[model samples]
Target: MEVKVTSSTILPSPTSHHSDIPLTIFDRFAANIHIYVIYAFTPPTPSNADLISALSKTLVYFPTLTANLSTDCHGRPCVSVGGPHEDRGALVVEATVLSKLEDHLPLTPSPDLRLLHPDAENPKHLLQVQLNRFQCGGLVIGLTSHHRVADGRSMCAFTIAWGKILRGVPIDPLPFYDQPWLKPRNPPLVQFDHWGSEFIHLSPQSNEFIITRTDVDPSEITNLLLHFSPDFITKLKAQTNKLSTDKHTTFETLLGYLWRKMTIARQLDDEECTTLSVSVNGRRRLQPTVPPEFFGNLVLNAYPKAKAKALIEGGAATAAGIVREGLRFIGEDYFQSFIDFGEVYGDRDLVPCFEKDGNVLSPKIEVDGWLGLGFDEVNFGGGGKLCAFLPTWVPFEGLLIFSPSLSQSGGVDVFVSLLEKHAVTMREISHSLD
Candidate 1:
């Protein structure tokens, strides 16, 4: 299959926002990262011109995404909103793919799949989109948004708004972009001891704490899309609750189950410390809860650790309990303390260390839950609902994303990326779930 780039253009915001908006602590960390979301639709694809037109109008409310990324005198990242003639706009590309849309179903990370979205590292455009028209008359909408400007929820807001505009419908729960809502205390105080360990920052002792991009050979890794129907989730939840007196949430049960299975598959040392890092949305967890429509990064990582032997032997209940305990650390006070911690140490370069070589450096896994994100309802005019949704392959091993499946069958899709050998075992574990 071949993809040909047909046209490239810029779509500026319909209305001007602030001249310069300073990024929050959460935004600074993901300054160089870009989040990709691909949506596939059936034939009689929506008009590229119509989609672009709708996007232009949608930018009026989400102008921050159209702004260019810049650093202030303090060397901190900021969004620079340009004037009428400053050429501040998103990069829009139209391409033609010679393969059928179904051919790429359950997408994986590869050079071919990479062609679906804009360059991940490109800083010139805060938002980039690729409109791919397949030979089978199917449409694939690829979106790449700077992670510093918005989190997954924020991105969903943008797409939902664009879809509303295309369908000539009113957008509800309008977006809010004020950053002062999360301002740090006058005298920043650190309340959390584990903040330093979870976030990567500049250390006086060494530069190793700074996060950097690493490449992995696709052949050495395996990416799988596993589905868990609602029935299966209910059964798993029952099993977990039966093991422990406490009732386990579906998220905790699923995460615990996967962690246990992955550990067993890897066959790690019994005494080795294994950690699972779960992403927590802090929007509603904060004091005076942030607005549902607030656009930006409001997430924190919850790390739950246990010995491999204990985790495997304790079964799903123990693992799920550990996860529940980890989540307890993220509350109103914790989020406020985190913001203060960032203010005091915002200048430092904090990075996350992941396994680069074939060997596992640390026994760690990151699970990002994308459930209840409304990814399937994004319609781009003409009643075109998202048929499939998945992130292109990420090189990071042991990173799992739980997303809502597009089939609307009350199921969940677990996108797992692991070592080739471990992936083989994961497939077997998933098959056994049936």
Candidate 2:
């Protein structure tokens, strides 16, 4: 589908800048990557002007987004809300498609999806949005944001807040950035060793683990989306828990099943080790629970690994058990330890361990989930469910993302990025309970 650019404008935030905000320890580890999120609505969608008005109002609540990604005096990443003489704005692009959105139902991730959003690598603003209008009066909103500024949960809350503002609803328990709890203890208690798992030192004298990129043909990489029905999940849980009486959550069961299948599809050697980087949320697990509306990255990645032979032979049930335990390990103490590490280790040369992983993470898998996020309740566009929503094209392989199904209430939509051959093999065995 061809997209014609209509008009482009910068929408400035309406708020008084108090001061620049520093990135918390939780925010330091996020990669410097931007993602394009596409949300399409059918005909009778709101006018572009109306959407902009709502967005402007929403920005009043999240003024930090209008600012730029800047480094503080100590060269640490932080949100530059503004100084005495500085003011910034977000980028908004208006586009038009000559085809009806219904004709392109169930939109999948592809290079063309990038056309619906602003350039993915924009550095001027933390938040950028595009409004794509279809010939049939349908509308698709494309948004791109810097990953270092916020996490999935934060973005979801911002979206919901924008929706509420658009519908004339009060944003009860409004979003907040004042997190006094993140202050470091007087006597910083560094309980856990985070040298290798999360952060790696970047000092010249220290031997840092080097990351190498896999140079594979771009054409060989593909993104495959799969919809797992509710009934299939019920059977997967039953089959996975046959040996033990304990029931597992849908996430755990699916994580295990997907890991096993992906390993088999990759056809790894029996002795080769495979690792799954599970994203763990510390909001509720922290000592003083982080508020749901608190806007920032409050998460970490947990690693679960085993020899290929053991993982395959252990079956999804055993795999699920590994995943369960991996998540169980990241509790209040773990969060406090990471905070303590950041408190005492601040200003030291630091970088995320996973940042060096190359294009093809064959024996390694990275996962991010967006299930049960209440995104379905957003009614700003057409006063109904979004026609389509998913990640744009990603270059990495062995990456997994779980999203709530747009059409199925209790179902899941799995997004897999892998080598074309491996993707083909994974799809062939996607539905098997074994």
Clash count of each predicted structure? 9, 0
Pull out the clashing pairs in model 2.
none
Alpha carbon lDDT of each predicted model:
0.78, 0.83
| TM-score of decoy 1 | 0.91
Off by over 4 Å in 1: 15-18, 84-88, 106-111, 120-123, 200-203, 206-218, 347-362, 431-434
Cα displacement (angstroms), candidate 1, residue 194, comes to 5.1
lDDT of 2 by residue, 152-192 (tens): 88888888888888888889889898877777777989888
Candidate 1, poorest ten consecutive residues by summed lDDT: 353-362
Model 1, span 63-123: residue lDDT tens:
8888877776777667877665443688899999988888876555454676877665453
**lDDT, residue 269, candidate 2:** 99
lDDT of 2 at 46: 78
Q: Which stretches of candidate 2 lie over 4 Å from their true place?
A: 16-18, 83-87, 121-123
